[model samples]
Target: MAKTTSDLIVERLIDWGVDTIFGLPGDGVDGFFEALRTHQDKLRFVQVRHEEAAAFAAVGYAKYTGRIGVCVATSGPGGIHLLNGLYDAKCDLQPVLAITGHTFHDLIGMSYQQDVDLDKVFMDVAVFNERLMGPAHAENLVDMAIRAAYGRRGVAHITIPKDMQEWKVSDEQRSKANVPMHSADLAAPLAFRPATALLEQAAEIINKGSKVTVFVGRGALHAREEVEQLAELVGGPVVKALLGKGVLPDQSPYTTGGIGLLGTAPSVDAMNECDTLIMIGTSFPYMEFLPKPGQAKCVQIELDPTRVGLRHPVDVALTGDSKTILQALLPMLKKKDGKFLKKAQERMKDWNELLTDRGTRTDMPMKPQVVTHTLSRLLNDDAIVSADSGTIATWTARYVQMRGNMQFSLSGMLATMANGLPYSIGAAAAYPGRQVVCVVGDGGLSMLMAEIATLVKYNLNVTVIVVKNNVLGQIKWEQIVLEGNPEFGVELHPIDFAKVAEACGARGFTLERAEDAEAVLREALAHPGPSVVQAVVDPNEPPMPGKVTTDQALHFAKALLRGQKDASKIIKTLAEDQIREVV
Candidate 1:
């Protein structure tokens, strides 16, 4: 049988080393689906309930494996649905490829059904965007798209018209004089390193400082050992951006967990006190959490020269991969007195003790912290975890200790809602043998409840821990603390997510009492297939910052005065939480 454009595109994807593709099938993509069916042995198609989830899953897979994740969809709405997830990949700089089917070529400008000019729609999000014109264009388009995604570390998009998918690919097409040939072989990643002179200059700035700090991010994950050595040599705490949570175990002597709003007290202190700031592969946007300008001499190490010194002004900039740059810079760093690091460790110890106290309370309406703290203890050493954006993120950041080979990620800069389940699905697909868990809040999980069915269908082992506090907890607090307004339109009518899970053919557990959190979490985690643990928690509890500013306290008080809902209960919980540390 003669090959078609769809066949050639699929073959090219296989050649580029893509084993999995996530998407939903539609009539516009029927020919492509047929091609996928014919090539089933070489490619695994993960059908998602929503096209959005499919794109999110691709981003998740790319994030976990450092490979070019691929997703597919039909025309118009399906193509539009992919924008959010593709934007997430673009913002985070993850490599991903999105293929969407368009209307028949003749019907494109005739306002045919599902014709939406996807090329223009995807222009802002994709690093490379192209369309398949005929059989001759398939291989070259796919090759160039994948290359662009990898080279730019962003999204690449291709729109195949319904009619084009059926075009024949034969020897005659290849023999055409106008046809251009291209190679589909996968290329090695560029190994970037900074010069010795730049490393020496960074070291000089570090050597002069008495109190230095290493601020790391996801870019530093590959150079854990080097980051640790740099922290030790500089005699300062190692603070991580949220995406960099697992780079060093929380228990490391040189580490202070995460920075910014969802961060520890010790990290805030490190940033405030440090005289020299070494930013390694982290473009953390929270300028308020960092040292004020001129308080510290900054040295930035970034692989993308365009992003170097983007967040903070740098005394020296080293453009290279973190592992190689740190390796070259480490030897030049002079050892400093252990005093600075020891003080930060003492502060971190105190902070950890406080977190333990907050997380162990045995209140009837379970504290959200207990859920994360218990899950942290029950997780396998090699587990992969994903979190949703909400107060649940605050709890996960504070309580979940990343150790061993455990991996963790969330919607870092995008901070989108309802990504937890899809991210776990992607992680499980990428590494089938490893345990995967998704930690999310009630509101976030409800946004994509249908994905639970996807897990059951695939028989993917994923434990979803839902902190069921019937409110949009994060925004509620933000209104009170940041805006000084009474919470409005934040209440969520309760749904028994456990029952919902059971209805979808997955095991479900509920935790109404704090005492049962650990036991329930253990069972859910040990379940052989998909499981859900709906933990009823106290909504009055706020995601308190490590340090509360006067304005925040005033705003919180003002909101209460303006008749915030459940004002008395909120005050009691807030007071009790704050009083625990001092007493």
Candidate 2:
């Protein structure tokens, strides 16, 4: 039999080192599935319960491995379901390729069943989007799509018509007679360095200020040593963006924790007091948490010139690889007194002490911080941990200490729910035998609860810690704190996620009392297969901002006066947590 487009695409995927493809099969893409069956030994297909989970898994795989992730779906609704996850990949700058099926080429514009003009729908989300024209278009199109996804660090999409999936390519079409044959090996990533003159200018700006603070983001993940060196050389405290939480450990003396709403007081203070701000490999979006415009001399080092000065006004913008740029610029820096760093360290010590006290509370309704902090203690040193959006993200950000070789990620830019489990699935797939954990709120877990079966099907060793508060805790607080309104339509019906996990052939543990948290989590994490720990926590615990203004305090008071359902409980929990801080 002659080679078909489906076979050619699968072969090309293996060439590019894609070991797995996450998707759900439909008749529209049966030919591709058949091709996958033939190549099952070479490539694995992870069948997800939903197309969105498939896409999210792909994004997570890319994030963990720094390689292109591939996801597939059928025509129309299947393709549309992938939009949220694909947007997450795009917003976080992860390289992912999405392949979807289409209607027969003959019936494309006739408004046939499940016929979506996917190319048009995908234009804004993908760096490269196309529909396979014919058998001859397969090789070049696959090559170009993968290349575009890698080079641009965004999504690449392709829609294949059902009729064309089995169309055989002639020998001449495979040869260079009609189209140029492409190589399977990917070109090395560009390692450009900024000019020496530009580095010196940034250095001079850094040297001129005594109160320097370094800000790092996801881009600095690989430049940890360089970042530390620069901080040490300038005697500045390093503040991390939420996505860059793992770049430096919270235990480091030169560091304060995260910035923004889910950040620490020391980080906010560092930004406010610094006369010079050095941003490296980050485009942190919370401008309010940064220094006032022109209040600090700023220098931004980024790999993409287009994103160089995006988040702030910079006196010097140097575009290059983060590790390389920092290495080149470190030597030109002058040493300063450690007074600024020492002060920040003092603040961090107080902050850490407060967190420890909060996380160790033995109150009736358990604090969510205790769950995350306990999980942090039980996690393997090199575990890959992911958190779902909502108050769970806040808990994970504040309590889960990143040390050793631990890796952390979440729906950073998209801030979408239901990504927690899928990300763990992807992480487990990326590195088998390594420990993986997903910390999620009840609302987010309920959104994709069926994935519990996916975990069982693969026997992936992932421990999901579900914080069941019986309400949308994050949105509830946002209403009171940010909007000054009484909470409405934010409650979630309680779910016994542990029972659900057992129904899906996984181990399940339930923790209602605060004392049971550590043991329950330890057993779940060591279960050897997929496990779920349903932890019922306090709903009234607030996810307060790092730096709250008087306006926010007024808003909370107004919300309580406007008849919040749990006004009394809210005040009690808030006072308990706040009282600990003052002492």
Candidate 3:
């Protein structure tokens, strides 16, 4: 007897190790839903309110578990909604399979309700895109999509027509269509031998120079030890990008932290002062902050050839796996004396002291840096942290130091808001026993507040901390810096986030004082189920140790002078506070 195509698809998914799928059902996918109902015990389907949230949830699951996250949506509008979250998954390099339902094959170009070219729409965001042309091709297509997503570490899309849902095939034929496991291909020839030679030459230049620095990127993820060894070999300090956080231990003597708009002081200083700069595994976009090509010899090692010399001109460009390339250079590199290393270490010490002092301040209404530091100290060493975009992300990036066992997940490339709660839900679902914390700003939390229902439905024991400042704080700071005006559209009417949490059947608390933060956080962390702690912070407080150019400072000053005639003295005091904190 023949089996339905939906059953064959489910069988293939099982073979691919997908036991659960996060999605919402519609008329177009009703037949597929029925297939799921038959295999209810073997394959669980999580129903979500919106397709976007479903996709976001899959990202969290993929990051935590290192598996291909699967989500389903109906054709057209539902599929369109999945694009934003799928893009987030794609950029973060998470493996996701987005399966959507389509109209009958004969209805092509007929303008049926919800008819759209899903494969074309999702092409840019997904690594692989295809519609299952017929029942015979379903098994092979599903298998290929899964492999592409897994191997490439990106999103993949598969569109299933409604007519193909109930089509049948023999049981033996279905069993033969099982997805095959792919082995990691480590034997491929390294791409950049000539580039590697240039890197060696760059190393010689570094040894000859007084100040050398390494700016690490996401490309160096697997080669942390090699990169650290390289830094030590040449007496250079390592500065990471936001996506490259925690690649090496934060406390490593050679590590100088990240450099960007939301960067630390020592990192910015190291990059600026270096005589030779080595770019590893990063296609960093901010060319203005990079060392001028002539001032510092810039050498870049990347996997993609197009990325080489695309941003800042590279004096040397090596295209290969960071591990393979760095390993090759290790034998050729000579041990350098410690003068440069010592200077970099001293700068790092000063930076660490500055961060410690600012975090210990008692006068501020709620020092965000202090709160993040305290949370890092209080949480379990193995805990997972998911931070939303905006000021909260900036604070977390600077303050949340990750230990070996701890995992930090964020929407890095997409930089999307409202990712924290759903990400936490997905992470908790992926690792039910591990402690998961969702760090969100007031504005981001308000956008997808309904996902709190998902947490409640799953009874996920994730702790959510909302930084409540009654404004879109990051953009407000930008307005203060650039436009020299008090922010107009950034202010938000206050919402009782704790009460909302309670309404969603999760425990909730409101923290008004900084002193109460630690205890409240500890309590929430200890809760048996999902909880929300709304931390009301000062709106006017400035982010610590922020970098401002001379021109930016002038703009800020002009804005302050134009707006507050009598408050010029107060503005000057605030600006002085930022400067003092740096030293």
Candidate 4:
């Protein structure tokens, strides 16, 4: 039998080290499914309840493994449903390939069922977007698409016509399985080197400033050792963007976790106090948290030249691999004599004491901090956590202590809801036998409750800890800051999520009080199969910002003028002994 495009693509994927795929089968993709069936022994296809879940799984797979993730969907609606998850990949800068099916080329313009303008739909989201218009160069096209995604560190998309799925390739092309280089293996030795003059320019700026604060982001994930060395050489404390949290272990002497709304007070202080800001491999938005233009001498190091000075105008912009750029600039730097890093260290010590005290409180309507801290204690050294957006993320950011070898991921730039469950599913699927935990709020969990069944079907060991605040807690806080709009629609009617999990054929549990938290979570953690532990947390506890400017203080006064009753609860939570000393 002659080789089909599906067979050809699958063979190439095999060579690229893709042993699994996530998607649901549809009529438009019958041929591809048939090809997958033939390759079942080599590549396992994990069927998801929704197409979006498949995309989320792909993104999670890439995030966990540092490799290109592949997901497929049928034409039209099936393809459209993938955009949210694909967008998550794009925003987080994960490399993923999305293959969407189309109707027979003959039927493309005739409005056949499920016929979408797949090219147009995916163009904006993908770095490389194309439709497979012919069979002659189909294999090369697959190679190009996958390479583009992995090289550009963004999404790559391809549209396939149903009729060509079984088309025969040339004898030479169909000879035998010859997989191309795996994306990960190829990327390891690849790096761009900056010019010598730029390194000297950056070093000069760095050496002149006495108080330097280093900012790192996702791009520095693979350069942990180099980043730490750079921090030591510059006599600066390191602050991470939210997605960059685990880049430097919290135990590192100069590390101050994350900075901004979900960040620690020490990190906030570092940004405000530093005279020189050395941003390495990060394009963190939230300019309000940074020193004003000209307030600090800035040096930005990024591989992509276009993004070198994007966040703030820099005195020196060095473009190259983060590890490479820092390596060149390391020897030229002299350690500063200032005490900025020490002062920030002191602040971090105080902040740590404050969070630990708050996280262990036995207050009724258990604080969410307690839930996160407890979970952190229970996590195995190799555990992977998939946190969702909103107040729960803030708790995870501050309260969860990540010490070593553990990975933490969340929807960073997109900040979308309902990604926790799907991301956990993906992480578990990719790394069998490893514990994957999803920390999400009630608002996020309820949005994609159906995917719980996917967990049971695969028997993936994922523990989902739903922090039940029974309100859109983050949005409610935002409303309060936006001049007390009387909280029009932030309330969430509490659902017994454990019961929902039990219905889906998974173990269900609850933690309503602080006393039961450890025991209940331990039980869930030990469960052999998927489980949901719904812990009721205090909704009124404020998700405190690291710093509150005078304008924000004035806005809070306006919020009080509009008579926000919920504000009283937040204040009461803040005044509790656990927070009083810190706030």
Candidate 5:
């Protein structure tokens, strides 16, 4: 017997262990939805306002759960909307499968309404992209897409022709499910060990260096204990990439927070000052922040062989998983002199004091640091905090300490805004028991504020804390430092986000002053349904580097000379040790 191609898709997805699909209804996808309606218990559909949100939610699910995320959308404009979120997943190297409907095969070349070539549109973003040829290609294509996504650690896509979706699959196609694909088949390339000869060369280089620092990335999240042990053995401090921020507990003596511009003083100090830099599982770009070429030796352990030596010229490139390589190397080395570690420790201590003072200041307008630091205290051990890129990421990166079983995720390489709400929705949907919190700025929240309705519809336990600074804080500061120009197009009118949340059928709170922080946050977090807390943060607050560049100071002077507004305010922002804690 033969079954509809739509039923074949649904069944194959179930075999892939996917329980949920985020999407919107469309005429082209009616057959797929019909199949979904029939398989109510096994397959779930999450209806969202925009196709973009569906894609972002899938990205969040993949990132937070380490499972292949699935999302669906219909043809033409609906499929077009999914590109941005799919690009985010591609950039972050998360595994995702996007199933979209297309114009009927008969209408595709006829220039019929809503007929677009989805295959060509998704070519650059997807590692594997194609359309179903017939019912016979359904299971094979879907399996290949899923496998390709997990293997390459990127997005894979499929577009089903609206008419072909109704075609039947033969009984011969059904028997293929007997040899179901196992989860073990999706293991990341890092699971296997490198050659013994490669390991030996890496160990030799690591043991010879007296002043070394271990840098971790998202790949090291599962290997934190091994990373900490290796750091202890080398007498080195560990700096993190933004994606790897919560790998080592914040309180760890051997760990320093994230690197690059959004970094801590200790991480900056260690990277610039180390004689040997051991980069594990991260290909952190922005070479200026790293040790200059010929200044220090390097060793990188990356699962992808092509990515190794791509950033820095490597002395040893061990192509394997972070945990496997680190565990192997840990036994071969003796502890080095702690002189470099001591200097970093002292820097970290001083940095902590400055950060604490920054977060504790009781100013009229609540500082962004206070927003994150307060949340740090309110967070339960098992919370998943998703931060929007921009100024909010600065506060979350350096100020909040994600300890215990808590996890923190942000738009790292993509640096996109508006993902916070969708990410929280996906995270909460994936882990129904754990609490999900999103820290988003006014500009970011406004990008996808409508998604609040999605949260309310799901009745998820999500708390969105909006930082209302009324400015594009990160880009504004960058203009001053990078171009020596006063802020242009950075100012924004303040918005009462609490009101927006209320309109969407969720609990809302407004904390205008610093004193009301504790009470409002408590109320918002305790809300059973989706809640939003709007805090009016200080506009003068700035995030600078650990050591201010001469270019930065000269640029500031030039901006002031150019008759920039609030010169005095700019001076205060620069001088307030509380404001530029990272710098």
Candidate 6:
């Protein structure tokens, strides 16, 4: 029997082991959508509100399942909407295949509706970009796209013309190309020599220096055991980046937690105290936090040669896979008894103790730390957490202890707002049986709150916990720190997020106080479908365990006095009346 080109594409996707596709269908891609309907038994199509959400869902799926997640979009605007998510996937090294429908071959260059240079636009984001000029090329392009996504651990885009989608071909005529699998093999002896020389130089520095620290990143995820072993061998502490959170267990004595603006005290102190710093699989961008050029010798190991010394001044650059370099460096390194290890371990203990005390506080109006701690406790052991950027990220990073099985997904590179809700929806769709939660801030939730409709439409069992503080907390914090006063634009008029959820066909609850939090969360989690728990918290509460300087404190006090004089007077009169009645 003859098969339509769309059928061939679906068949090829099935061959590539794709069980689900995240996307929206339109006129340009109607044929593909129709073709998907016929294969309903084998493949599940998840309809999302926007192409960007679909792309993000693909990223979530790939991150959790370690498979090539797929998303489809119509040409032009639909395809363009995918760039942000694609950039996230690309930077995070998540494997995703993006299939976009293009204008008909007959309409080529004539500016037909929804006709644009999708291949060219997607080129920078995707590891491989190709357009299907003919029906015969469809299978090969699909296979290549899948292969590129897997091998490069990034996004790949393939554009199919509407005319090509309607073409018919016999089963025998359809080409079947087997995609190549990724291998962990090293290139050659020359590749080893350069890396070996760099490793030797790094070892010499470690041997001479009494204090050395190891900083791990996402690139080191695959070589965690080796990285840990190296850390132990050197008796140095291992600090990870946000993306590298679960690569090494947080409870490990060698683990010093993450470093950056959102980093913990242990990581900062360890990094600053170390005489030599070894960076593995992380191109951490904050040069201000990194050691000065001549302060502490810096050694970096990365797979991409271009990334070497790009951010910080690298005294030694090793170009290879993390595991490969670590394996080679293991035998050459000499074990040393150093104070760096003991000092870092002690600092880690103190930092953890401080975080635990702060997080467990039973304060009125509810502390962000307490909220995150309670959420962490209530969440399923294997629940996938998608956190949006801002103060919530800082809180979650500090308090939420991720287990090995619990996956944490984030828009690391893009740091885009409104990502948490859609990302969680995608995560829930990808892993339907697992509990998926989106810990979002008020500002971020407002950005893509409409995705709640997508959740209801799909009946995805995802819980969204909106931290309704009525302001961009991170921006507010920055204003306090850098500007020395409250900014006008940081404040937001409160919205009824629970009502918004209810209107979107999902269950909703408003948390009025700290005591109401646990019960509200439980009800949301127990709901059969999507639910939003709007946690109302004090807008003026500062982040815990973070100190304000004397000058900043004085400024804050003066601002409070000037701003709340009338309110303070009313409070004082009430207190005086109560005292007089008691007397």
Encode model 2's per-residue lDDT on 346-441: one tens digit a residue: 999999999999999999888888899888888888999999999999999999999898999999888999999999999999988899999999
**Clashing pairs for predicted structure model 5, backbone only:** 545-582, 545-583, 546-583
For candidate 4, write residues 348-420 as lDDT tens digits.
8888888788889999989898999889999998889999999999999887777678888899889998889
TM-score winner between 3 and 5, please give it: 5
For model 6, the superposed segments whose C-alpha errors exceed 4 Å read 170-201, 457-459, 483-485, 526-528, 543-583
After TM-score superposition, the amount by which residue 444's alpha carbon in candidate 1 deviates from its true location, in angstroms, is: 1.1
Instruction: Write the residue-wise lDDT of candidate 3 on 1-583 in tens digits.
Output: 5678888788788877787788888877777887889887888787777788889989988877767889999888888888888999987788899999888878967999888989888979999999876556677778888888876778999988887787765432433444433322122243454455576786676666677888887777778889889888888889888767757767888888878777777787787888888888886777777787687877777876767887777777777778888887777777778677788789888877877776656655666766777687787878988999989988788788877767776888788988888888778877889999999999999988988888888888899989898889888777766677655688899999999999999999987776777888889999999999998876766663346677666656666666733245445447546563211
Could you give candidate 5's per-residue lDDT for residues 206-307 as a string of tens digits? 888989998898989989889888887889999999889878888778887878778887888898888898988886877888888897889898988989
* Candidate 3 off by > 4 Å: 40-44, 151-153, 170-209, 564-583
Model 4 residue runs over 4 Å out of place are 170-189, 565-567, 577-583
In model 3, the Cα lDDT at residue 538 comes to: 66
lDDT of 6 by residue, 1-583 (tens): 5788889789888877789899989887887888899998888998888888888888878876777889999988999988888888998888899989899878868978887989989878989999886656667677777877877778999888877787776533433452333222221221343545667887787666667889888778777788878887788888888877777877777788887867777787777777788899887777766666777887788877888988777888887778888888888777878567788889778778877776666555566666777787787768888898888888777777776667776778777776788778767877889988889899998877888998998899999988888889887756654455544587788899999999999999987666666788888888999999888775655552232345555554444444432334323432432321210
- Lowest-lDDT window of 10 residues in candidate 1? 171-180
Candidate 2 versus the native: TM-score? 0.98
Which 10-residue window of candidate 5 scores lowest in summed lDDT? Answer: 181-190
Instruction: Give the least accurate 10-residue stretch of model 4, judged by summed lDDT.
Output: 180-189
For model 3, how many clashes?
A: 0
- Which has the better TM-score: candidate 1, or candidate 4? 1
Error of 6 at 143 (Å): 2.4
Which residue pairs in candidate 2 have backbone atoms (N, alpha carbon, C) closer than 3 angstroms, thus clashing?
none
RMSD of every prediction: 1.7, 1.7, 3.8, 3.2, 2.8, 6.1
The lDDT, on a scale of 0 to 1, for candidate 1 is 0.90
Q: What is the C-alpha lDDT of each candidate?
A: 0.90, 0.90, 0.79, 0.85, 0.85, 0.77
lDDT of 1 by residue, 146-197 (tens): 9999988899999999988988877325545544654555655767777778
